[model samples]
Target: MAVTQFNTEAMEQCRTTVSSQAGQFGAIGDGFSNQYGNPEIFGKLGASGAVSSAVSAMDQAGAQEFEAAEKVLRKVESALDAIQTSVHDVEEANKNSMRAV
Candidate 1:
């Protein structure tokens, strides 16, 4: 069987990048709402409600996507750790058996 090696550092970096992107999107949404989404401005356009709704939807979607990706990565990391432990245990058992012979 081919040895399975998990690049934990790379996975962690990917998770951090996704989290940072999510945070950046949230900050952008906040800034957009505060700057260009002024009630007075949107009211003058006669689409204040529609604009606010769109912004909220985008923010929610981004958050959900990031959250899902992070969860998957966490699960993968957990599985990798379990596999490593199991492999080590098997190796130790084999060594003990050989020493007894």
Candidate 2:
């Protein structure tokens, strides 16, 4: 069998980068709401019918979309977990194989 080289360090770096970025999704989502979706955004002014409905709908959609995105974010975390597990498994397998040689 041909030996395949696994660059553990590169894999680790990629995982670290992706995980660090993924961790920021929550804060970003919250910031969006705080900045744009706050109910007080259009304070002291009368907003009704299509205008109000549109804004409300947009805000709600943003919230729901963010929530759905959070589900995807969780999947990303799970993927990282899976990657870590695979890294460990592969390293162990390589060690065992080396010992057998």
Best by TM-score: 1
52 Cα displacement, candidate 1 (Å): 1.0
Question: How close is every model to the real structure, measured as TM-score?
Answer: 0.60, 0.59
Model 1, range 39-59, lDDT digits (tens) per residue?
455656777878866776776
Model 2, position 100: C-alpha lDDT score: 43
Per-residue alpha-carbon lDDT of model 2 for 13-54, expressed as tens digits? 776765665556655566546333444556756663446567
Q: How far is candidate 1 from the true structure (C-alpha RMSD, Å)?
A: 5.5
Which whole-number lDDT from 0 to 100 does residue 65 have in model 2?
73
> For candidate 1, what is the TM-score?
0.60
Q: Give the TM-score of candidate 2.
A: 0.59
Candidate 2 residue-wise lDDT at 18: 57
